[model samples]
Target: MTNYLQLSNITKTYGHFTALDDVSLSVDKGEFVTFLGPSGSGKTTTLMIIAGFEKASGGKVEVGGRSISELAPHERNIGIVFQNYALFPHKTAVENVYFPLQMRGVSRVQGLRQAEDMLSLVGLKGFGHRHPKELSGGQQQRVALARALVFEPSLLLLDEPLGALDKNLREQMQIEIKRIQRSLGVTTIFVTHDQSEAMSMSDRIVVFEKGRIEQVAAPLDIYHRPQTSFVAAFIGESNLIPAIITSGAGKTAENPTLGAFQYAGDDALADGQKVTLLIRPEHIKLSRSPVEGRKNARMIVETIVNYGDNALVIGRAGDIPMRVRVLGADVVIIKEGEECCISWAPDAVFVITK
Candidate 1:
């Protein structure tokens, strides 16, 4: 768990337009961290800075306890895979993988042999003879990955490597990439706007927003206990309600439309404090009538979105929009434009003060 990579007070600016502001983070050796955010949120900018392709306005980029800020992208000894596989169409897979080692003065015989071994690690051993055009998108990605890892760089940066693939291939590559990353034990940084991709592949997720880091935590923590409203709303389907604390010690808050609610959290909230209550859609139970002993609300169903195994019920409860997740079979019990009862226990409510 040693801090193998450190970005201390990193900042980037283009004239008066600041792209990143005082951004800093530490990554442990062999840890898989994903930089997740929307476009223009600085995630890609941070990745570029770390790769030495973009210089920082301030602060340092360190790897293995040494400063790499002064190094060129090639001299930094880091591997990068972009959204485009960036394979040489004319070169065979093995040859493409060997190109990096070839540049470093390794003999073609030795480099190709090492490249073959790396290709095997990425599940492309027998297919190395095929040119980029002969390989499928996923296989081409594996070749690109093998090429990046062939030199055994200090770090591996994947910038939306699965972006161009079909859905099934993207998911399959997620597993393969993680397997290859774990096998190599390379400290890696992944950049993506895909939330589910980040959630599935990362050991930790760093959420960025408006040129700053919003929160960094495990996937579940970032989803269930997000420190800010942005993080809560950004990571998943959430019904966020604005409320004022009526009794901090009582663990209660009151919304003008939804009435009083008991939230579950250990934060030190004060009476009359403004806050937001986050209730995940899945936490709610949609029923015909009030479920005794649980908090209940009447929602006029507006839209029903079904996804084979489950469905989302979107509607308004009083003045606040609400969403409830129900199994596909149970969703038949209600219809759009019909009123239904949505209930949940106190523990289902999470408080967001930020």
Candidate 2:
């Protein structure tokens, strides 16, 4: 199927700094895609270009296979929700939602009815008469969302919509936003620097860096099978170990420290070539008794931290710090500064180029 939205070879620059560099991506219809990265990573810049708030220095923005570069922001039929809940203080909740419809030439009676329905859809029934100041942060966000959807735009663009709320409210709103988007089947694009938020809500995440695309994949794939070292480090907590590819067949390779491991299928580095191995904390296993299967894996526990639900065992292999997360019944009665052997399956280690 053709993508509902397409950004082709897009580039954006501001003075001496480049905000986006030949970034291209596609969003399928009804897909919830997120642009995720740290500050100044060009995630928000890409969203602004797509929303027509900023013009691309090069390339084109397409919606539903049609070029939308020349169209004005209002003419593109896209709804945008800013970080701050942009509700008018003087207007009631219903009036704020109805404003969008009224701008499109809908009658007062019809706009009010539609706005009321939208308020109800966002779980704010009977809140039409309330002003922005009277509602909680979550409620205010709901109103802002209702206003964005009231116009029935072809696409929805959320620019850190939950950034202003407290942690608890932000999480609650994330679930609500996902639920509402799924119910409406709206093609949505969310921009955020929070990895957890993107992982929870996105069908796929596009990790950006210094005005360029770093990696684009499903959350699990991005975490476990990152194509670059930057992606493995950015998406989640990982222990990066520098190793040489000793031997291999297909994607499986043998490392000196972690023993035989599997990497990307396209990895074709020669033997003795320096490569970095990405191992997640949860992937490393700790055993009080001798580990029977891992003869080639070399590791020794250096420190242990009890964190209630789980224990973080810091292990060392050569000069690198290997973190292992022990949970469930396995975490019972493990003291800090104790010696324990740590090992991981060959397939659990993903090697990436530095």
Which one is best on TM-score? 1
Error of 2 at 229 (Å): 0.6
- Encode model 1's per-residue lDDT on 1-354: one tens digit a residue: 899999999999999999999999999999999999999999999999999999999999999999999999999999999989899999999999999999899999999999999999999879889999999888889999999999999999999999999999999999999998998899999999999999999999999998899999999999999999999989989999999999999999999998997988888799999999999999999999999989998999999999989999999999999999999999999999999999999999999999
Total backbone collisions for each predicted model? 0, 0
lDDT of each: 0.95, 0.85
Model 1 misplacement above 4 A:
none
**RMSD (Cα, Å) of candidate 1?**
0.7
C-alpha positional error of residue 78 in candidate 1 after TM-score superposition, expressed in Å: 0.3
Tell how far residue 283 is off in model 2, in angstroms. Answer: 1.3
lDDT of 2 by residue, 149-255 (tens): 99888999999999999999999899999999999998999999999999999999999999999988988889888889999888888988776776644555555
* Residue 53 alpha-carbon offset, candidate 1, angstroms: 0.6
**Candidate 2 minimal-lDDT segment of 10 residues:** 290-299
